[model samples]
Target chain A: MGILGVILAVTNLVVVVCMHISFRQYGKYKEHMILGVTLSEEQVKDDEIQCLLEKYRKSFRKYIIIGYITGILVIIPFEWYVSIALILYLVWMFGYIFLIQHIYVKYHKKLYAIKKQKGYTYGKIVNEITIDTKLSYAKDKMPVSPGWFLPSMLVFLIPLSNKGVREFILSNLQMSCVFIGVIVLVKASYLLIYYMFAKQRSQVYSGNSDINIACNRVTKRGYSIVFVVASFFDSISFFMLLWDEIAMGSMTMVGVLLFVVMQCIIVMGMVVGLIQIKKKRESILAEDSQERVVDEDEFWATGFYRNPMDNRLLVPDRQSDMNMTLNMAKPSAWIWTAGIGIGTAVLLLWTSVVMLRLDFVPVTYQVADKFEIIAPSYSKTIEFDEIQWVTLLDEFPDIKASKQNGAATDEYALGRFHIRNEGTCYLYIYHGYSPVLELQLNDMKIYCNSREDGVIQECYQQLQEKLSE
Target chain B: MIFHLNMSSETPIYVQLRNQIVLGIGRGDLLPGEALPTVRQLAEDIGVNNMTVNKAYQILKSEGYIEIDRRHGAKVAKHQKDDKEFEVYLKDKMELAAAEAKAHGIELTQFMDYCREAFGVNEEA
Candidate 1:
């Protein structure tokens, strides 16, 4: 629990720091835009505007200090209850996100107000979009072919080649499906993002077709390469699931943590790629001496691109992801927004509830017609006919085993485990408790005990009586 | 040359596109025989309806500023021919603009200078 708490603390700190830095970046000019408002090159140098930008930076930094302090105070102390600590940590993350977004919008509006006062975009063709006709005529080549996805898909399927993985998956089809389904969905969404980026209006930087082509080519290629590289990261988790079933140990948790680390690595790679591409585009922009810069600030007055003129369903967000935002003018955009909103809510709720259950629900047993042992999400029932023997041991079996699935913590292990001498068994045991009841079934063994010592003894006695009759 | 378009502008989108192209040509930014993007491509890039671009191309073609070929798409014409209909329309449009300029307290000399500047002429010239 302490180790997990420390890891969670580190993750929280990283997220908070990243959020602090990334949100601050929006205040600077990029692609001729600053704080979601477009500005003239001359206006960008204005003293009063610079002061406001300084305030924008300082304001977020001040808020971040408080957020960081609060996160440390809330997440670090409650390390004993890992579930509670995790929930608090998530809440802190959500709170920090809300805080940053709120601060960003507040400053975005302020910058826009200053822009209005300066008449930067006023009495002007602020909705100007520079398109290099020649470049447009020779349509941009982006979006990695669907064929590129086959290698990652093959890696995902590689686990099926192993006999243990196949049997494990076959026996627990639903659980495995849900797990695999999540990974597949993530990959599918990324592919969708890639397609949207391809379909998106290419960034037309200058009248010079060559400059425009160079800028857009690097941007698109950078995005394509980043997604392609990250596409293979998920395949590692597949082998992680089956590593323990063959070589017996707590490899599942290690695998999950490794997967997380890989995810972080991919995100860092994307950031690096973005930085390099931006530098390249900025360098090439110097060549095209006379280029029209767009200032569609009115459309993005709310800090989101809401252009009715832009026919594309998705647009590259000025923030983190390339295709994270919707073109609000499209009616279908509302459906997409609602879907995202609902999906996020469902995932958050499901995770919180699952975590809470793992910490609170005690191991339980009922022996009526069938011997049912249940704990949180991991539960199993053994039929009376299948049970060949039942024994109530005074001492807990100190057997070497590994968890196949379920919650494992310092307190208990409640799930499927493969015992070294006993083969596969459904275990519902608490470390603090003892004298567990063991049942021998046709193909598998069951070891479970209740929190109440008397209740466990009663269950064992009743099972024995029922079996004799 | 980059075409600056504003959806909320008083001028129609197609007219904005047409004016930019004409300016590019007069400024020599768009050279004679230089190819233009096809209607579909331009429309897609600018995120406008295809008809808007088609209208601009048709106007440019009718005024003898460009030639549209099935294979080569639209290309800037080597020579801009004088058309009676265009002269008449230009006269009417210029008269209205001059009237608007007068209302805005612009002198005839200033208006002439602005017009000359529009034609890419220096004050000394």
Candidate 2:
């Protein structure tokens, strides 16, 4: 391939890789943000809340590692042939955003609707000691959906994929960053928008009845901005790439660098948003926790806590996901996030190095060269047509394929694989460049290369062994 | 002691907390002049809003069930010669429960029997 082609190819690979990383990061960010919104301070105190946090954290950690590893394994050789995998991954990315994420969000809304239909939720009982009647606001009703900002942010992933104009820029470190920097100009605009809405909606959500409406509007507006900005970034980045020579000029480079700096600022803005939400959640919960202090006349007069709408706004009396924890007083959460973040960064850096090595090294020099392997027959187009799973089933019930990172060495390609069987079970194996598969029939270890001869020979050998066993 | 709060119950959490404390006092679970839990502690105990326990304590203080001093914490109040309200309160509680039980189609004997079973009473009359 020509130098420009190589650069374009590599840039695309890098951008997609970065986008994937960012996508995962955004997922975690959204997860935490949603949790931030949904979880009250009282809920935080609850063991269930802690469990869910840990659960999300664990899932986030697992997916990050899996994705990174998969990217390394899948992209190294595929970087040469990235156009195909890139297209596939983009399709999958869009599918996940529109299909999976959308469905989950819809389910959440449905559940919330059901709960709202029910007059009151019977919250859990908390503590074995110090039972108090007047202080208990457990029966106070709250809506299942906290508001709109969360859901909007969540579904932005779909539109983001649809607007792929910035894909090139987002992938190209030099140009993509310039696109992000240009968005800094819009921050003032975003703030202005936020200010306008905040002013207009200041008194809108004074009570429980306003929660759904207020939260909905806020989230929708917030999400709309996010999508709009993403679209801008996409197109602007593409345009910058179009005018590369001029864009790469000294003056343009300076602009590009500034844009990069602005992108960093945007990242910082996300961090600020995260912190503000957390602070708001904590303060609201703290205020709710002190609900028992209402005077006697106020208690019976308005029947505030007792009223269904009022109850939803009141603090829960049970051990919910939101509760104040003794541990919360300590700076442990920050320390934990920092520690894990550092560890994750280190892991990514290490994997990136490994992937770079894999990508740069010639295929002949790899461990494949070490094995005195005969070249596979280029013409032996064995399609594996014996009632194979992929073709026989209209939709394979449980066959799932995920990008495997580095689960196995270069000799045996490996990383992360996800398999889901929605219906009937059918066994199917992915045929890849250097296949390292442990078959189950008689438990045989089989290794094969993309070369037709090598694969067939290995298959025959495995079949012979299985027959003997 | 394990404190329970029923958020849905008509009884306010503070009243429940107070009632539990009084029961604890009568059962000799708490001694005279013993420090009861602080407002924060009581709030944490029942998992209800802290203000609920605080409200209960304020009422308890007025009724002389407990005394709150910053240095000493909430202590079981000293006994007084005039326990008139205590008897009236006890009678009122029994009457209300009995009336509710009767409304639920339970005879007085049946209600007493249910209470005995519930409390695992082995005391001879």
The CA lDDT at A66 in model 2 is: 55
Clashes of 2: 47
Give candidate 2's error at residue A95 in angstroms.
Answer: 12
Per-residue lDDT over A242-279 for candidate 2, one digit per residue giving the tens place of the 0 to 100 score: 34422332124334444444444444444444344434
List TM-score (chain A only) for every prediction: 0.85, 0.30
Question: What docking grade applies to model 2?
Answer: incorrect
Question: What are the per-residue Cα lDDT tens digits for candidate 1 across A118-191?
Answer: 66662234445666666776554555565776676677677778787677666655556766788788788778
lDDT of 1 by residue, B35-118 (tens): 888898788778778999999999999888999999888999998887788789999999999999999999999999999888
Error of 2 at A87 (Å): 19
Ten-residue region with minimum lDDT total, candidate 2 chain A: A374-383
- lDDT score, candidate 2, position A160: 45
Q: What's every prediction's RMSD, in angstroms?
A: 5.6, 22.8
